[model samples]
Target chain A: MSDRLAMEDRRSSRLPFPAELGALVAMALAGLLGYLVFPDDLAFLTRLIGIVFLVLSLDLVTGYCGIATLGQSAIFGVAAYAVGNACLAGLVDPVALLGVGMVAGAVMGLASGVLVAKFQGLPQLVLSIAVGQLVAAMANKLSSVTGGSDGLAGISPGPVLGIFNFDLYGRTGYVFSLVVLVIVFVILLRFVRSPFGLLCRAIKDDSLRARMIGARVYPRLILMYGISGAVAGIGGALTAINTGVVGLDSVSFERSAETLVMLVIGGAGTLWGALIGSVVFQIFEHYVSAANPFHWMTILGLMLIVVVLFAPRGLVPLAVSVVDRIAPRLGGKS
Target chain B: MAWTVLGVVLDAISYGMVLFIISIGLSIMMGLMRVVNLAHGAFAMIGGYLASYALKSLGVSYPLAIILAVIGAILISIPFEFLLYRRIYRKSDELTQILLTIGITFVIIGVANYALGPTSKSIPLPAALSGPFDLGFRMIPAHRLFVIACGLCTALLLWLLIDRTEFGVRMRAAVDNGDMAEALGIRTQLIFTAAFALAIGLAAFGGVVGAELLPIEPFYALRYMVTFLVVVSVGGAGSIAGALSASMLLGLADTTGKYLAPEYGEFFFYLAVILAVFLFPNGLLGRKH
Candidate 1:
């Protein structure tokens, strides 16, 4: 009976293919579709891809780890500045700039993680906002390095593998960002399913219970924060490389809030929701602003209220539930 | 140097007063309901815009326009309190509350932007309060004097209302423990609505009166949100006296920092907030849960 139970458990866990691989294929297909459909607006789409990465990173901490923060943009902005300034000072290789961004992001994550782990609820929220604002203020004040309100410009990253140049049409940037996103998503998919990830989830469910089970909750959260920061940094670096500029707006409170909104709209904790939310929001924003720049905010605001009131678990989860109800057999094992 | 310091102090006091008026309602609401109303600034912005419109388009007297704005804000908030916020009050999740309030804030901002244009609108000060007044050592703006007076009067009235009245007692009981307050036969929901309306009225009054200091614009709601949050958090969420003191302290620090180092003012301000939160996690006067 024990042997049969072990066999059943293994069968339940096993799949036709690794889930990460399937997700990667689906993501690559989506990228191809995006590229094929909007060849003219690849630049905007590329920028949106970069933002999607930031939102995904936000999900890792706020979603999986249950650390409520509005300062993920702080790390993103810091890494962008690091890469932009480094490139301006002769480090033009795309991979090298990404490395710089990742390191800077990790450092920021560790510092902020300590503060976040120390407090609960409102204090934690206030601290995160303060830290984000502080970093933005510093960046603005240090005009010599960051270019202040004018923004850091003249970032010219070299080709990826010396084959595709960063072009004005954003063709190369689009493919480059898509590849990086897939890589990061796969790594995160694995990370979130690991034993460590389960421990983090347990902590989120109940930190006291996790501690009672001897989980050392604070250190685990801090590590998760650091990883999330690195992911955000990569996104920021891609933005710098794609746009060839980094502005103070990148780290502003507005960006932080917008990312959080996207995460909530997509469904927190579920990784795919991040991408879905960002895509829908950015597309809606683009068209609406293009048509009526003045009233777009009203529409967006109404959408937010409706989403929160009606579908608190977000669109992705709602979609999954609907799919399950429609075809129980097809939804099996997901 | 002494004169400069005096000027800074006076400016800080008047500025702090406006902050207190706008934030007191927020402090009370948070204390009583445990709801983080991020839309508080948006309500204040509406009041400012309404008052400005009354002065500009309706040709109403400044004092009458202020009163009208306050009434209008309360009337508008009543429906929201009953329909939206009423439901939110039942759900205790902080994130949901934050999201709901933020949605309301965004809608307000959008409406303000569409209705009042993106440019800043100023309420025309009456002739009596338009110019400077002669003092022993220096000239002081009459507008500043009026603001200071209003601030003092508001503080006194609010003190009497919250600390010395039966309703105040019920409200405090609700804040301390809602279940117990209700168990004693107090209709906490009614108290919450009344308190919410009162808070909205105060915010509108402050927004109209302090338009000169803070300005009226579409982004006004988002712009002052952090400042208001800092004030309330540092003051201790529910303590009125704490709000007053925190506002003054922050107001002074802000004024002094801007005067001394224009470039690093925000840096120092946020740094101070970080250190304050780190040292006093529950705010200066907040009780640990």
Candidate 2:
């Protein structure tokens, strides 16, 4: 076991710097390109950033921890509402609001994690869906505070360091969200490479074996869920800050389902896949709906089916495989 | 207060009947095949739309329209069973099943929206089944009575078919242990196909019958999916009696909650699900594996 651990550590360490550096470069480039190309749609792009965070967080539980959930939106919604409420109550600092969102997410995550960790398979799926719907129903029912279906509006997050104003153009929002995304992404990247993350992967691969090895499975799962919730909350906070409105839809079953779909499409276990899947799905949705407002859903549905059948591991892994075949030949010549 | 209570009870029974008819197919499929047919609601919606179209546009008799609708839905599902569901049955992954079914659901919703329009479609019930029937104490809608009767008949028929027949025996064996059933020369694949068709047919029948309670709309598939799923899960997936009882309980809870607290009705319903799942993870009547 010690030898295997050392070997695993050596393998992970061998390629860590280059892979991490590549991911960092790609993310930065994607942000820069989005800013350059779609200046008019910064708000939409910023919202996508938030969704990507949620999807990545979903990967932490689903991909790494092997917890099949459809209720990550529960924490996301709670965090959004928290941020909105905090803003309403004269807490205008964006950073502070983000902290509040993460804390709320962690609390909800811990609560839900207990329920989720108790069950397995179909029951777990059902429990997650129930939690998500319950949260959405609560948000809708609490009209006085949540603003009901109308949603909380006019959430003005006073600029980053009081310099870049959140203008009509959404430039400030985009940059602010980009910065947070990078920070969270780096932290997550480090976490997923650490010993704790290795234990999570082991648990996911075979919980029985992990348990037999004296690993406390339930607590680890709960902690993973809490961390996941915190990440989702950060995403929710970003959305609330950038969009200046938080609606019941954030907590809806539809959001949960869509986020899962995004995670799957990008690839489940890989962090980069979450980013790619969210971007591709959001972009495809935006363009398809713009082109054919009525039939976009059909097209998207077909795409999902095709993807599931052909590329079950998702587009990122598919791309990686193709690159793997080509990279070796190119390296041989060089 | 007594009359109101009676009213609520009657309403609950009728709603429960509708839910039972719609969700039984899903329950059986999940129990036997271990496939979470999330698109079950889509089949139901398709049945409702087809029946509504035939009644309104084609000027067909209600009974014939319903029969045709069920047949149509069955025909539609056969190809899906062969091409899509058959492929995934071997995977045995719940997430894959969910994704595939959700994809099917999205397609069905889109097609229904395109064909039937986004607006709700109402089935014009025949005059015979439309009016209120007077009892000594209260007047109840004849339609509600019809739903109740149909539901009871379905339950009795299904119970008989599943419990007292050779095919039922084979199906039960297959559900209990597919390899053993196959080894016993049960032809599990054929049974699966037939069962899939029957489940779709049942969904269509329920869709046509329960149109008044659940309006036929483009979004019908997505809208009622969670409710149907909740029913199947709460009822313990495989047991007919469990589905029946759970549907009734949920129906009563939903109706009473809506009456007592309109805004938090859905909230309470889901809360009950959470508690039920925590208490009985395999569902109230689900067999321990």
Candidate 3:
């Protein structure tokens, strides 16, 4: 995985500041800008951040690790419901709830990863979908615990770090989610650049070769999937906190499919691509669906087709190229 | 108890036949082209909508409606093949193929909903088939028998086509090795187009015939996508016999599971799928890479 990307990484490393720091700064600026721009829609922005986490986790497995998963929502939904139930059972502390969510997500991720890591290609894809559907079915059938199709509601999470109570305007929630997003993004930036991440990439590029060379491919894949699940779980926990509800749709096939669409639209295999893709897709959808609710799917479909035809690498890379063309000095920075 | 058991078996067989019919096209396409065409269900939905349109709006006869739906769907799919699908065939990325097809599915869904309203469409059966048929043990819907006959006929015809016909020989050769088939002057592109058309046609036929079991709505494509994919994958992507057996096995699991425990019906169906896929990672009869 990093073999194809090592050149770009080295070039960016020569820049004045580290690429990761720049991305963190950029995310902070964007989060603040979004806050100022959409004060009324903070709820939506918070949800978008949660989705950004979902897409990032998806990138870890699908984009970086070369796993084709359409069932990532299982991890996300599992953590979310876990947090929701924990809240209902009197674990209202937002930070602790997030921790609970991560554990739940990692457990579910590892459980599914055990089976999913065994296959590759189309079978792998089908297996992931099966796992996702199985989780969803369980969620639906165990209505007594999960609240089933009706969803778990009334989950009013306590304030951020025992201060900044979650208000109706969602100002606190928005800021809290942004802070967590930045933290997760920074950690993930380091995570992907680490030797372990590179090994995962090498395995993704050719597991048989990696295995021949003495790499324990299965454990690495399973571990990466577990980490990915934790990330997705945090996102789910955020959703549960922000909206005070965890519906069956959280674990639905559609949710998983939509997450994939967001990842692809952003461009897979890159963290910035994941973040940019989810944010752009969410904002684009926010406006487009608002304007033409009936034809939103058609518009989105056309946009996706256009992207596949012309910008197969996704919007982030596409934007990067245009910026590079305009400013030769900035070309190497990205 | 025996009568109920017999009823469940009969319903499961008919339902499985419907699954076989709808999913075989997807199975063949996935096996032959390795395209992962999620839009396959969109074609089926289009066929159902067209058949319903012909039945209610045009007041066409039942058989005529089915014929019109199949032809119309094929015609509708030809452009997609040439313009969109042709470009996609060159790409090796499974993600790209999946995304493109999903985009196509969304477009079809949006258009269907916008043009045909969100309400479900029913293909009112002809009087002859609408009534129940008497067997020695039980009276079953005549439509089930009709669907079963259609499914069996499709199986026999497909076997004859693949095993006996020149076209089938070329198709098998292409599936076995596309480059080798092309080297032998088989015109693999033309073969693919024809096969694609055949797949779309079969999907239309299934959509119209199986509409009683799986209703035709704008969201039909996305709703039953997993089910179809499950059958094709379980049966083995390219193997007709694999698909037939998988469909029947899944069909039995789904029906009996529902009978045994209504709430856990989907659970048993998916559980069976996981176990089957686990047991046969390449599918029960899929070719080893």
Candidate 4:
């Protein structure tokens, strides 16, 4: 089992044409297909792309680095609120606002990472929850700034590159989100394949062994957290722009928990898992909730339990295994 | 000023007792079985709902309602233990346990909402407990006194049960070394199931008792999950004394913080938690392995 996991990690991290390039192509096609299929629901699609980023960031620390955090929304929400406040403060430029969000997210991530990297297991989980709750409490107490429970609205961003305006139909926002999602995905693909990423996996597999081999474990963990925060920040910024508001929900415990669920539902520790999980969970939720809001949670909960029990590795890996059984030539490529 | 201070302290102690009663089960389970059972709160919710149902629907007496709630919750937990928990108990990884338990919690919350409606359920106090009782200097609600007395009795009984009985010795042996205890002719599996049932029963009792403070809403499971987790972690898992002190400490901090500075809300409570966890990762009374 350990050997197969290690081999799978190697196959994923290697810049193999079949896995990495193919995944990139698949992501692009999926995003475009989403845009075409649901042109009228551009806002929801844009918001989903934002969540995709958040889950990818979560995959970085929790899946790859062996961190058990339930408070990821702390970083994501901080960056989002930063961009919202910036836009309100007359920074209407979309690209520049995203940079603000990224920096804000990184700062919060690094700060949280410093505290979180020192512990393991249950204590670590509690600490993360504390951090997330602290941010949320502060946001609530300082309601004058955050708009309190009503959320900060009236965020108006100028078009992409000062060219395309954010239309009522959300066309510009959807395209903008898609383009940014693709760019981040490509960068993360390379970032994970880099030596730093390999060192992270090594630390995750066995931190004591990595330390014996002269790796600075805590520093690397902190750095990975900062990178993750930046990715989450982009997602936060996109949400701020697309929704034209940032609310307490952005930094909520529920959001953090939901994002983790999405990550696990698709699979964890793999880039494809993060992307597919967010997409599938979000789309499933959209349809299910619309059909029956009352029983949707029960259905979702049942699905989650089944996923955990039957497909502990998540849907993406389960699909891969099934495909491998049917078509050995195609399956063996990865 | 003295009266106000006394009132606040009494409220704090009562509130703290409720928290302790609810979270001790979670603490013991986490410490002993090494399972992060997020659904523990759901058991508490079930207890609260059952007690409320008994009181309002069946017109049962207060003590009988509490008893029924505890038994019902334990009975309900048996299937979950056999089907879901038995499978994951031996796994080395915490992630699978966390995910699977979280799935259980979601299902419980969803089902509770669907069956019982989303409105909050209140367990009304009996006429005897609802009235005010006179202290030498002032009057206070008898319910607060009742809750505090119940908490003290529970703590004492639990202490004796774990510290004095033959079952306690076996439990400690299993906790110390499961394989060794099994080799010594102890049924570790049976001990685990019994312990789990005990934990669930206590959770139900706490829920019924704490309904005044926490309320029995559909979202109760998720809302108070972090609170219960904080108490257990702060108390040091498996350490009854640790759980007691941590609950009292947090309870004091939260109640006093609210009284002294209502504007601050739960800021101080969460801040204190962060500082506490950072300072002592193993918790106050946790035994270092």
lDDT of each prediction vs. the true structure?
0.87, 0.88, 0.90, 0.89
Pairs with backbone N, CA or C atoms under 3 Å apart (clashes), candidate 1: none
Task: Please give the distance, in angstroms, between residue B114's alpha carbon in candidate 3 and its true position after superposition.
Answer: 0.6
Candidate 2, residues A201-304: lDDT per residue as tens digits? 99988999999999999999999999999999999999999899999899988889889989998999888889889989999898888987558768767777
Off by over 4 Å in 2: A1-16, A330-334
True contacts kept of each: 0.70, 0.62, 0.70, 0.65
In order of DockQ, best first, we have: 3, 1, 2, 4
lDDT of 2 at A178: 92
Instruction: Supply the TM-score of chain A against the true chain A for every candidate structure.
Output: 0.94, 0.94, 0.93, 0.93
Considering summed lDDT, which 10 consecutive residues are worst modelled in model 2 chain B? Answer: B87-96
Model 3 pairs whose backbones collide: none
Q: Candidate 2: what lDDT?
A: 0.88
lDDT of 2 at A328: 97
Per-residue error at B147 for model 3, in Å?
A: 0.7
Model 1 lDDT per residue over B63-148, tens place? 99999999999988887788788877634666777778888888889888887789999899999899998887689899999998
lDDT of 4 by residue, A231-330 (tens): 9999999999899988999889989988888888899888888998999899889998898775887787778788888988889988988887889877
Alpha carbon deviation, residue B67, candidate 3 (Å): 0.8
